[model samples]
Target: MIKTKRLLLRRVRKEDWKAIQRIWKDETVSPYAQYDNIKELDDLSVTNRIARWGREAEYYNHIFFAVCLQDEIIGYISCNRCVDAYEIGYCFHSKYHGQGYAKESVLGVIAYLLIKIQMEKIFILMVEYLNYSLDGRGKCMKIEHVAMYVNDMEKARDFFVKYLDGKSNDGYHNVKTDFRSYFISFDDGARLEIMNKPDMADDEKALNRTGLIHIAFSVGSKERVDELTHSLSADGFEVVSGPRTTGDGYYESCIIAIEGNQIEITI
Candidate 1:
């Protein structure tokens, strides 16, 4: 069993078949049906159903979990193993609709996979993907194989090109996202993620988190660090600290942005 502060991921049992079937049967659900009205799992014996899944789960390639919220099962989240990663799939019961429970549950799922399953990479592959571009720019970010949200498709497209197109400096990227904005990624695998919060608003709220944190970028040498900082500052991205060595042997500086996100340069 993989348990988080608010949820648990455990094996599906005979008792869960009905709830699982019921959730799948809902017409309101996307990806529509597990089986058509004619072949609906109405007649499948519970033992047979369990036997079907039990053998498969034992294979270690697929782990089917009944997502339990507050000790009560309401949905299912599963990971299907691929060549070098796991694809996560989840479905929630409409009965628990609008609770933000899905997000929390998925968070738990990631932690579970990272900690227990030790999955190197996990991707969300939605059947009918959705994305939220609250930025009003109508742009959507083609993120790590996740659902597409309801937003202006054009703006979302432009958003990816302008900000989220996976470019980064020294393995880091900071960009505006929907609502609060987002941090983009680079090809080498270092990633950044943030909400739709703009630099101004995020900066203000970030200081409230009470601890100091900043994005650190490494340059080739102290002189190059100085040159880059001077050029970037001239270009209007606030340059904070730098050319100074930390007690631990790295040279660095912090630049405060209107959003309070830091641009740290180091050598």
Candidate 2:
């Protein structure tokens, strides 16, 4: 256990799962986490997680420390030994953010690793500011998927698959409400959920709508952008804007696709 001015850093116990669950469920915290199965966490899974942490600590010297403030677990820090240094990752309850608790706890862990454990170096992993590895090698917070209501789910699914090169699932249907949906996945691990339901409102989308104006996709280069813009235009999709560089220097084009929704293709 390590103590700071107002916090306690200790080895996590099985009972700490509830506190950890609350942290994981926080909207501000979970999306940035690499725990794709967080929503499925329960007694069994959390207990197994704790047990796995124990095994990791024992077998590989990897450590997970629960951060406590005033006798309450508010966050955790994980230190995993990389090839040459320890990579540190952490998450705190959103309520405790900007309180310097994270800094203090990280300092405590760094001290323990460097002095007590006699480690050579430490690296702090920042998920928010970096493109995180998706090969199960590191933690990152990115848009898992975006869901949108569409009139024709299959048409939307085919549009993404044919033009955007998205691979879609078999699709899902609910017998009770006549609801259906498809999960379209892209090469970079991003996803789009197109859903449909009976009697869903088909509101006329205005030009200057307030909420969620568009979804932008990066196609890697100006040539690809031009090719896709021309392809989409050939397919009768209205080109709303240019394949020319914008004032901000984005080589892109805007189009009306997927049920009148705006899609931006950029380099």
Candidate 3:
């Protein structure tokens, strides 16, 4: 059990399913939840589902905590194992919204995971419609740049500038470390930093490798996607995938560009 000033977070019990069901039934909470058949689930089904969650906790370390206030279960926070980190998700009763209980409980749980469990990383999972700002001052946050290590920084910078219409700044160089980089900016305010350093390991980028696989840019239309894709292919860059509509409806093409990195041009 993890306790904060006004909240208690403990491993969920099967008996707590009624409170969890009540929270899930809330109009405000149900829409964002993954379980679509909460309304159709009978008491037996809900209990079985809760038992499965408990089993997952015991077997896989994927834990679901019942967030309680004054001895009442008000909501739940789930922490699922993802690679080396934990991905967390939460929901609460609508009446308890905006009370800071969720925030307090999340902090307590995070502290417990990091300090007591010796966890290295924790990720918060949110719904697609929700905008989570990392800025503590209540200001809007945006990605300033995405950076990557490259062998030939100039070749990488030229690839972006020539094909993708990226504008490059006068590159930076560190005398002590022999490090160099260039910041290539796009018209839509996105920036990419291509960097180089001595003795940097160049691992073979397997097609199914994890981590960042590609950087995608929207070119405004399907026609533009086709046009640019043909242009890149004509210029000898390998077109790894088509300028075709994907299963998820993305009209895009993937190309092996800039030191074996994949770049996706989309509409």
In Å, residue 46's CA in model 1 sits off its true spot by 7.0
Tell me the TM-score of model 1.
0.42
The weakest ten consecutive residues by lDDT in model 2 span: 31-40
Encode model 2's per-residue lDDT on 153-217: one tens digit a residue.
88889999899877798999999999999999765367899999988999998767899999998
RMSD to native, candidate 3: 17.9
In the order shown, the candidates' Cα RMSDs to the true structure are 18.1, 14.5, 17.9
After best superposition, candidate 3 residue 267: deviation in angstroms? 0.5
Clash statistics: count for each candidate: 31, 1, 0
Candidate-wise lDDT, in order: 0.56, 0.80, 0.79
| Model 1: CA > 4 A from native | 27-39, 45-47, 127-267
* C-alpha lDDT of candidate 2 relative to the true structure: 0.80
- Tell me which residue pairs clash in candidate 3: none
lDDT of 1 by residue, 196-258 (tens): 323332123453366546556544345656776676577576655565777766666666532
